[model samples]
Target: MCGIVTAISTDNVVPVLLEGLRKLEYRGYDSAGLAVLHEDSLVRVRSAGRVAELATMAASRHLTGNIGIAHTRWATHGEPSERNAHPHVSAGLAVVHNGIIENYEAIRERLTAKGFVFESETDTETIAHLVRDKLNAGQPLLEAVRLTANELEGAYAIGVISEADPFTAVVARKGSPLLLGVGERGIYAASDTSALLQVTRKVVYLEDGDVAELKLTGYRIFRPDGSPVERTVTVSSLSADAVELGQYRHYMQKEIFEQPQALGNTLEMIAGGNTISPQVFGAHAGDVLGATRRVLIIACGTSFHAGLVARYWLESIAGIPCAVEIASEYRYRVSVADPETLVVVISQSGETADTLAALKHAKQLGMDKTLAICNVPESAIVRETALRFITRAGPEIGVASTKAFTTQLAALALLTLALAKINDRLTADDENTYLTALRHLPVAVTKVLELEPEIEQWAQRFASKQHALFLGRGRHWPIAMEGALKLKEISYIHAESYAAGELKHGPLALVDRDMPVIAVAPADELLEKLKSNLQEVRARGGELYVFADAGSEIPESDGVHILHMPEHYGMLSPVLHVIPLQLLSYHAALVKGTDVDKPRNLAKSVTVE
Candidate 1:
């Protein structure tokens, strides 16, 4: 996915465009470019690297314009090069685009037959050429953009500017994120609200097939059929200060330590209650969740792991049948969804490509009862669903998620309690008890964070290991899987997680001295079984690394090293157990000299498949 920003102001727009693009750098940072109308002529600058390079080039060229559009690319259709970068210009028209054009080849061939020559290997160039042709044929600027939007297929969030109508900047979106920021100076269009936070707090998020026109005075939006539509402009509650790194080594470390406050904020609405309330979800939450026959959770990456953990909670506590599916895998398969199914979607960025597709797929199957557990309140998932819970985990900059994951778990636990109350499976006393646990969570998490120094030493030991195995049973199995995923994501370690009982089947043979085994041993009923599994690994010449809760009675020995958790959190053990795993992976990646925040081949949001 690429980030696009467009600004039409009274003064020079290059500086504002650059600042907005910098804020959106988290969406993409491979290549950067911008086209500004200077002296009634379009001046386009393209750089083959980060936004800094593009900013430097624009500064050196003295780029100045009252109307401009900017982009930071992730190189989807072509390699990252100056020519392939965005702001593809043709015939006085400039365009910045995100998402893939499914019919790009066909469009290119048609444009080529019209005697228009191509310049770069990007699908975005086709839009520029097509818009140029439209404006050449005497079409208005907004009309040309509307016609072009219908011509191209697949998802796209595009910003288009032309010398013919230099006062207007047009932006449109279909199956991708785009928002309009209403500021005192002018109107701004960007891929995320974060981009406009520095200039404007009021924003209007575009729905699928909505086209907007940004002018110096104001902005106007329309539906796919060219009919004028009204959009609600809401003030963003996101603080720009949260995106700053006050005193952390990296965004990953900062976000990891922010879990307590993030989770507390997420749970604040329902934590002080003596009884669980369905109204916490949304206006129709009670009716929708009350009629739910089964639960289906769709998500990707760390969000998917959170869904897996929710599956156990829903089925065990709420007495409902729950199934978790990887959003990417779920979209391709046939689903026999019931009309009474509650399709819950989880995402941190809320712009995750496959998860959005899967949500649409479920809706297409006539499952109208849906809920989105998301971090961003203005995200597409929140607007698409009838119910939502924004996990106020505040701007997770790290590609490897930390606070976002734990906050989702806390929200899911709330969902579990609310659903249990509806089914009468949970007593009023039980609700108060769970609420108390949630209220105490911030303190509990602070205690867990105290083990970071010890975990860092364990990470130092883990830095040299090439292969690793993680083991947990029942509800903790997903925690083990998440731990392994974090290690592989940042540290580049080859790791896998297996249920403790599954170890004897086949994984025992791979447990040599070269491979270390990490176990999640909570003070639960399954501790004895997990301990026996650890013994199997130890006998096979594998070093055992155990994160055991206090009262688990797991003593450290010569080959088996144990990190004692200060307390056992009963049903909330998974939440506390995951902190050490995060610290371990972060410090391990630090020791291995790997990218801690922006790991290779990974972006913060997966806006494309």
Candidate 2:
């Protein structure tokens, strides 16, 4: 969850490093710092706060150089403090790292025994010591980093610079994301493309275990074995304005409003089409879908909730058996391997560490038929999968996902239709009907976004509450889970979700005047049963907030509050039902005066376990 930006330039790079760190704020960092080679001497500045604070510190200290490395760290091994900040230096070698070094303790002991002192309690410090140790052995900058990387045993994206080698900075990635930025002024390295979009649109996304050495004029890539390699440089499609807040107060709010467009973009290929084609997924999707007898969906967080919804769609619509697994637990537990199962891995960033590991685990189990539904193109998960669907959610900057989740649902829906067609479960009329619904889905979400003003009123009430219980039935049960997640993520509220029928089991006890019970009351077949569950909540003296379909006839009563959706979208209703919940969370966080974009203890991309 940390960020790294390294540059070797012909001019002062403090501004570039600082601005790059600011761009990576969405990745969620508690500490910021930079180390530069000024006059062939290592000069470092750090702050246990925002990039702005680091910028101020750098300015006050007149920190300027032609070559440098910067970091925005989300604490892992150490607490958020100046002493624990990155740009960990040893023997004139500076290193900033993004992922965990699993064997840091043993390495730390070895280094300590060898009389190498550590000033910071970070796994990153071990890398600096190791690299500096290689330098002490008379290795060059690139060789030193490559030798140190060989000793590392966990995921990491690291940037290293040495005062003795002022002309170069070496960056490497193994099980984490790292890229090289090419520009006229300098050569750069960043953990994310967004960080270097300002410096250069052309970037070489380094493969796992690839290392790069950056100089003012050019860069060179090497494999883990120190063999030379070449990576393709591609232009990024993301604009600087794509990440801007624009007129919105926060990125979360902006992303919430962007859902309709995101969904439209994700499903754009199906427009004006009467049939749902398997080719929409990939070139071999037809063969894969035709052969898939069972589906196993793997993901984490919001993507996991999306998978839960997909399970219902895959089974009920396609008449195929489906199961959803939390990626972290799936890999650790032993399970029966089914060769007929189509393993679907979903992630917004596509770099989720657990999900990727789980995919590898499934592969190890001989489940070779793999698919990835993700937002970022060319992500590790996408590359690992045999089939892929790239959601055009653009860039989701908020730590709490909005557009990405909805876009994933859109992609999953397409997959469902494709599979249903492949199995002959979907007739021509059925395909047309679902296609029309899919085309109209954006408009439906736009209408839901219009309910934000009304939802804000509900959020104002929610902000004062310490707990919430969300209830939904059938396919919408997962929507309830997602709503509760959004509330817990941004609003600092403890929220729980249950399938409406499960309320009587134990969650009903949590229902009271102080605990808000939010219900997703769509006009599906389970409407009456969900209403019965709501009645139970009302009987318990619980405050109720309901988002219902317009024609559901769930009237506003003394203790019940209702916001009717503009339409009932049948199987696609979960996609619409989630919009108001996102707004509710965003507004609740806003009313609570919390950080709406970067929630505490959360990062946009979970690159580490």
Best by lDDT: 2
What TM-score fits each model?
0.97, 0.99
Per residue, candidate 1 scores C-alpha lDDT tens digits across 1-609 of 678899988878899899888877765468899999998889999999878888899989888999999998887888889999889999889999999899999999999999999899999999999998888899999989999999989889999999888789999999888999998888899988888888889999888899988888788899878999999989898889888878999889999999999988998886656777898899889998899878999999899999998898999899999999999999999879799899999999888989999999999999999999999987888888999999989999888889999999999998999899898899878888888888889899999999999999999987989899999998899999999999999999999999999998999989998898999999998999998988898888999899999999988998899999989887788999999999999999999999788777677878888
Among the numbered candidates, top TM-score falls to 2
RMSD of each: 1.5, 0.8
Quality of model 1 by C-alpha lDDT: 0.90
User: Which stretches of model 2 miss by more than 4 angstroms?
Assistant: none
How would you encode candidate 2's per-residue C-alpha lDDT over 408-427 as one tens digit per residue? 99999999999898888999
C-alpha lDDT of residue 326 in model 2:
97
Runs in model 1 lying further than 4 Å from the true structure:
none
Taking all chains together, the TM-score of candidate 2 against the true structure is: 0.99
